[model samples]
Target: MKLKHYIITSLVLAVNLSALAQSGLQKKADNLFNKFAFVNAANVYKELISKNDNADYATRQLADCYAFMRNPDEAVIYYKTVVQQANVPTEYYYKYAQALRGIKDYKESRVWLKRFKDAGGDINDSKFLKDADFINTIFNAKPQYTLKDVKFNSKYSDFAAYEKDGNVYFASSRDEGVLKTHNYGWNNEPFLDIYVKAETDTVVSTKSKIKGDINTVFHEGPLTISKDGKTLYFSRNNFNKQVLGKSNEGITNLKIYKATLIDNKWKNIEEVSFNSDDYSVSHPALSNDDSKLYFTSDMSGGLGGTDIYYVDIKNDGSYGTPQNLGNVINTNKNESFPFINNEGSFFFASDGHPGLGLLDIFGTVSDNNKIVSVINFGIPVNSSKDDFSFFMSEDGLSGYFASNRDGGVGSDDIYAYDRTPQLKIEGTITDAKTNKPIANATVTLLDSNNNQIATLQTDNNGHYEINIDRDTDYYVNTKKEDFLDKIIPVTSKGVEKSVTSINANISINPNTNKVTPITELQPIYFDFNKYDIRRDSTVELDQIVSLMKTTYPNMVIKIESHTDARGTVDYNNELSEERAKATYDYLINKGINPARITSYKGFGEQKLTNQCNGTVPCTEEQHQLNRRTQFIVIRMQ
Candidate 1:
């Protein structure tokens, strides 16, 4: 009996000790997670999950760690398990939805998004709620920018390019000639350091560490410079005077530091006043006039994750209070990397907005220091991975940004891009009546101001094509020998395609001496009892002027005007005669020869198309039909 009792006590003791070990492991994992050391924390969480100890909590934390690290492929796997359990936070639904989008599973992403909404998630803070077909809108949009890889990218993470004085400055985790002794626990890469790529005649020559006391053993870089080249600002880990500062949670947040140029070298480094040990402040950018400094931070009372804030730079060199950019420019997710162009346009990166995927760059339309709306830079500029650190030139045409997308040389790579894409207008010119191709037709392209841009002739197959600019209004004027000339208004505005097809099919009637009513024109209506032409009538009248002035120079036409029956016969006669004279004068003013107009006359309510005479009550539509002007082709040669 004693031996059996001892065996039972030993078995209980072993079980209790195993439980105690698991409890200790859980505490260590939680500490790592709180410190933003997701990589280290993830390993411990996975161990706990494998042993089925605190499986629910361990699984959730593992998924969150992956999400924070931007490893969506791993995040989705664990999130799938966490979301299925009961009493889960609604934020997990949102995180799961974003993770699914990172993998390009938009349909399933939307499902969880709706679930997130149903579970009382405040989706109103984002632009996603405004567009139900947001995914398709992004995927179907035409690419306005083209990206090319740079030569200096390394196998590790490299990004945040800033150009100054013919030298490109950027941050990289590349190991140099020295042995790698320090590695960041978050990414398992060497600590970031600022490097300069020297450019001679616009060609990159050599890259080396920046010359100064700027670089340290900890993280540094993603910098900006002043216009006069006397000052520099950059982000670094919260370390100064050979001591690292940490928050209560034991995380070393980032801070902004400024350096002054002295004897051609950067020195006198000092941290910005707004930085705190409780939160992070990084990714510095300057406004066009250098009157304000913009940055990203996770300080207290922010919208959610990191948000963009700006501080006014006084003339005395002191900073004003940091002000948030507001909800229109922020959301409940991460937003960072604020940049402003010369025209005062604000640009940043955000995962909170409706984007193709994680951390797409967005621009804002602001009025009077308030952001009114946001615009996504759409595909090719954005991808399924994280894209940030947008910097544009003063002209707003060419720029650089960083992305961690596929087919890159590094985990994050810098790409030089231009807003100009190859846009084309192409189609065939065919005969309207016969549906046959009209070879050798001349097509003229004109700008919105009617300035001639280019001229092209159709090929033997009646195919014509011309390159054009995006977001522009154009007029395509096509002419053949015996066919009617067509001035088709074509616009590239809001077009999201590489090629826009517009066929200029010409219609012709060569038979002469037959009265050809101008059926293509809109109804030319004048005001009641007025002899002058209305402004709205000019577009229709211009067609007549164009027909006589360009298409058929030898064609002759006459104008006939009429008035409604409600007016007196004598007064109507006077008004109609004056209206006919006004139309004749308009044609002559538009460069139409006076000889082309054979005659002008007025019917004065004598002819009626409908039976709405004085004896019947007529609606406005019936009365409007009576007030008309007709341009009759008396001769065509």
Candidate 2:
């Protein structure tokens, strides 16, 4: 009897192991599907379905993958199998219609679309099909602009063009000579980095990698610049101390960071306070006043995929709670690369909206806190491929955007678009006494309403230029540290020219001896009593390292870290000391000289911000305020 029981247990164990193996494969397939690795995910689901268990679900996922890949022939096979089965999901019916339409089977696609609507797809959802007005709206659309590929595209993916001053900035995955061992499994391409091209006298030139401390070994950019051009908000893979941060499923999420221009370099980097590792936040777009930030995130509470969300920018440079744009602007599909013009015209790309194919750019106007109008950009501005990251110049005539349509220079390309005649402003900044060109001086352009239209810097030749809409009064403010700010006003109210240059020679009074704190640097915060460097804190620390390497090359500094009043005094002291050393090590890793760090010390609970002392009740937020890392300048040589 004992032998019989042992044999029975072994038999059960073998059966359970086989079941777990099949289940594990399903999870692997699901992860691949989520990441958009369609080809590999389809293979995995195919093998899973061969075992017959959960075959219906596996078939549906496989069909969806093929449909996403635009392989309608293969997708229709599995989609038909699933649709014929009883109790199929309403979405599957709709997806079947889309797959059939991909093969130009309009009549059969209409059949499935009708079934989808009958099974509860809203009339609005079915408008893309069986709606004459909607179909004709796409068919009868007239081209409003001409698009041509820019010179900066690479053989790999290159996209997300944003113009700042005279330079166009974008992200690219070109094989930049750096020998990175790992390639993205999805496309087998190198990670993205921001590239720039100056709008030269006759034409926009080929792009070059942006210098200073911005580019890393990982993905970067698809960024938005502040009107003053001194501040940049960009998307990057979550990282700490040069290591990528991944979620539990081994997927790296994106986060937004803020950095400012100091002296001639982009420094003072800090992650927006609300970024979390559990989800992604990327594709930043700033309001005209820079007081509101719009971005795309797949965090909890979103409609689905990645929804566009906005956060109020406080005066102190911190971000407020994020609010969703709601179902009107978001759908079960992704909505990303949001760009809002000065006229409050909202633009975003979505796959959920009725469109030509994949992701299509959509324009809308908001009034009284509601989406008043939403229309597809249509025709020339869109195609049967992914066309996103639409940005128009202030003139509403010409601009730069990105797309992955066929016949492009690379997997994606920056396209220069011209619609109407636009205005251009050009100038230079110099020292009044020496008459030498001032490179990297920040130039702020303000409209008649005192709205910051753009902020940029003078290049090595002290040259600056930007596109502006005609019929506007404007002022240009060129400023540099140790130099008196120069403001030049101009009236372009009646100028109807396509491109005009305003050649103003800005002169500034130099005051090199004055000592001013590095006010751009913000205090880095840590979680509880943790000392390990976090993704959010690395940006701030990188700023310090960058400042030391560039503007204050010979400056010495000290790290003063503190802890909250929660832990025992001895424990808090050790934790705070660790935090200080962690910050010190981070700077050293970033190539800062050890001799430049005068001291690394911790104050523990001795430096509590509020009365969050021993017996005082305090909220977690208040306690977090006490745990801080401060950078104190020791000397500037």
Candidate 3:
């Protein structure tokens, strides 16, 4: 047929014309997508399809709409169509492969990946793997250290590990070379001491060293080894350069110390006093790849009774502040023996809350870092006594931790059990500004996509902890009423990869308590019959401004006025609107941001507390009940 005579040319042109004509629809589609209205965007794309069947690009856009909305189920279909298009570039094949994987269709996804690669697609797409849509908690990785009762007679507790070359070093209270004696824990001798075992095949041999020269007469345990095995760091109670020293109270205190490993043996033992004194600073765990050290100390400047602390070892080998592990981990109840595994696992013991007894071992895995999965090692692993001081190795398998089980030899005996199935993450929570712990704060745990896992309030000491699973990304957010929320991101880069106490420091300014004292933030009241200004309003506003000036000086104030149901709806609406505007203008004149004022909505008579009909004249007291002015806090500086 001749081009001019045939109607097909016009028909095809008409489709293209319609495709271009859908400009208005395109804007709406973009707007919907911007607002995360992906489902609706897909519907709009569908309309465009009905209008112009030849719109291959629009068809593909529909699928992309679903992908952006994370609706993989629907996105897969559209992506396939996009690939089938004759004009689709090879790069588009890469996008298609990812969409198929997004829907959990690994089989189909692989097929597309092959097609993409065969079509000259870069292999980088494979590098970016999306976290699975679901989680399954399976105890993976072989145990590095099992529960071990090192105590010859009685067991106190043990934690912290030192891996130096071929030797596996750790803290224990079972027996030492010198008398095999230790503080009875209560008052007698403590049996705690640093023990060394030969690591034949990534497993600590039973022939680990006991009663080494480093284990003096008093107590010696909880050690950290440098990468070169040249430096041996540990904590001890009853400090002295020699066997034992004297202190005032029966302070079961601990101080950090280190010695040089000479000729495959520890020598020139020294006490770590960079930030410790006559107090307790035990449970020292060194980072696998970094000089940053982690330990538990009862130092006077800590946030609470017993807390975990960290110090930065600069390139020059100097120490920084003994930063408290913060409220995210430490609590009023003794939180001792913190051990982190490189396989995304954090182990510690707490007698504070939710445990079998004295000190129960717990594991915490952060999902999106907002909700913390707090799981007790369950039964058998935890007894009614102090069962803490746990450690784990890189393989995610058998590790060591001391427990005082019933079958042990004495009051406290060392016992070894399999590490539980769990995941671990470490980070800090501190005031954003001061980089200090937001004491007594609340930390919430969330899963990969920000779903809440669990929440724990930081003790007045400012630290939190919970056991979690290895399945999903865990995010944590630390929040206080008037402070900005903080998030601890849960990346699977290995929890123990970089060893610093998960010291998440959240910056929180002290909540401004304006001299205006209303006691509670409930609905505010205003004087009746007048909209000018009340004395009480000034008092409240003063406090409001006080807080505003300090925390959010530049924030805009949205003043909303309300009235009781004594008048017509229209009248009340107008009156409240005027009152609200008046307040807004006043704040503006006083140097607050007018641009920050996001306009006040007047609910007016709609939300009246009473239903007094016009026929009945309600008392003034009844009418005064609903008169109020409410201010919304937008954002703080």
Candidate 4:
């Protein structure tokens, strides 16, 4: 669960047909895939395709195998093939999009994501596409803080860092005494153990594993230490009492154990009372006052795969019943890695919410148990990979987080950084034609994913301001009745020196009446040989109706339809007449007065606007220009 993977459990169904019909080689591959041995399964699957046997299944499974192993490059090649094949499942489209994004091929990834969305797939529910430009500013902007990889990371999985008592403690799978040779089936690495490094060390030349009964051969320590550093709570598999407890599925569930440091020795290890063999309960975090313990669990009654939960720690030494953190902090997807800073700010990692990728760190503060705003820790604190296990210092200036992003020293690495304030966007809104302030216009702020984040209204002077994250994309949408909507995209490129402010001015055009001979509205279009009104044409028609009814109540309007020189003159004339009648009928349906309509007429190829008449030569653009639905006001009473 800490590895953060979204796997398809239907591999049996995925390869059944091929397994029944294919050679023994494919069956071997299928067996490996079903066991979650993606690294080995991909090789076997590749061999099947190289031998030209059951290439379709091999291609898809090979792609999926690479995807499971987080090899986006290999995954993209095979996914491209599988995604184009007919009857490909919706998940393939989403995987293809993810693979593309993993390789930083964002534009191409968006194409597949759109296809996935159109096919009713979630595509991780990200907003990277909608506010790409706005989000990019955060990437391009100067950073207020900097980060560096921790010096003591090993070639194995090393992460989940915490600092206490002048020592930096972290969980790692590095080879060590008694447990050096042991490896977990999940990742082929040693089980995690807590290692400590002195704060005064310059290059991390020495790391001492915490000596206690706290670590076991199975797994231990991504832990929380109490304020006095006497009590420690850590996560471990349910292998206590030398007995391996298993869930109904025969898999081990994680549990939180409490241990106390006594006379330089950690002893009195006991599992939390609520932990059961039926579900997992781990990732313990203590509040500043030690009155509450927060953790992650998949226990019964949870809203999703896992949720954040808390228990009240009584003064006399007992825990209250666990309470789910509610919908705002928990979603139907996994939420884990709770880390509370000294200032009462809550930080956690979740995949259920919209994020840049697999998991992103989010921060929220609570006042009197009421949740405040949630903030996303933007890049490079986050990446398109699993970023979690966030720990912030007391001053809120520096922190550490674990990530599996590329170029790391191990499967997971801890990064240290100082917090930085980002950028603020300020703007004014006004009428385009009059050059006057437009007050009360709703200005909605949207993130890169097209998710609405905040809404503000322009004041009397048309001024508005909002703080935004760095290296992110956003859209400022200005909307007011009787005025054309204006959307301005703003990006906060991370700056080296802090940016004081960025300004934007928006001028929206007001809807105009048709009393003037020329109007700014676009002409409606229709398909070839089509007489029924197209859906797009109705937009302009609705605007026309609104303008006529509101501004010129008794205006007499004329509908003119035209056509290109594709067919014979008589046939073209007839087609134009049908087009004219369709336009006229639409206005009538909209409750327009019958006597206000002057006439509806068709002027076919005879009144061609370009020399393309009678096959003189014209491009599609010219032909389209000739085929138009135009409106004119004959009289206004």
| Model 2's TM-score against the true structure | 0.46
List model 1 lDDT by residue over 1-637, tens digit each. 0000000000000000010112456768765654335577789999988987567767877886676455679989998998997556566787678778767787998899899889887664364433322322222223444665588888877788877777878888886436376777666777778888877534322247777878888888578888888889899889988989999999888899999999977899999888999898898989878888998899989999888999998888888999998998889988888877666667788889877677787766444455666656555666778878877766545678888888888777778875553456777788776778888777877777776655656778887765566677888888877677788887778877534443344443332355555566455887767878888899998987777767777888778998888778999898889989988898888988898788989888997778878898889889878888887777777
- Alpha carbon lDDT at 388, candidate 1: 80
Q: lDDT of each model, Cα atoms only?
A: 0.72, 0.71, 0.55, 0.73
Worst 10 residues of 4 by lDDT: 6-15
Residue clash pairs of candidate 1? none
Native-referenced Cα lDDT, model 1 = 0.72
- On lDDT, the candidate that comes out on top is 4
The TM-score obtained by model 4 is: 0.47
lDDT of 4 by residue, 298-387 (tens): 988989888999999999878999999988789899888887767555778888876667887766534345553344545666678888
Instruction: List the RMSD of every prediction in angstroms.
Output: 22.6, 32.5, 27.4, 18.3
Clashes of each: 0, 3, 100, 24
lDDT of 3 at 177: 42
Q: What is the lDDT of residue 618 in candidate 2?
A: 87
Give the TM-score ranking, best first: 1, 4, 2, 3
Ranked by lDDT, top first: 4, 1, 2, 3
- The reply for model 2, stretches above 4 Å from the true place, is 1-142, 201-207, 421-637
| Weakest 10 consecutive residues of candidate 2 by summed lDDT | 4-13
lDDT of 2 by residue, 86-129 (tens): 45656667667767776778899889888978887754544454
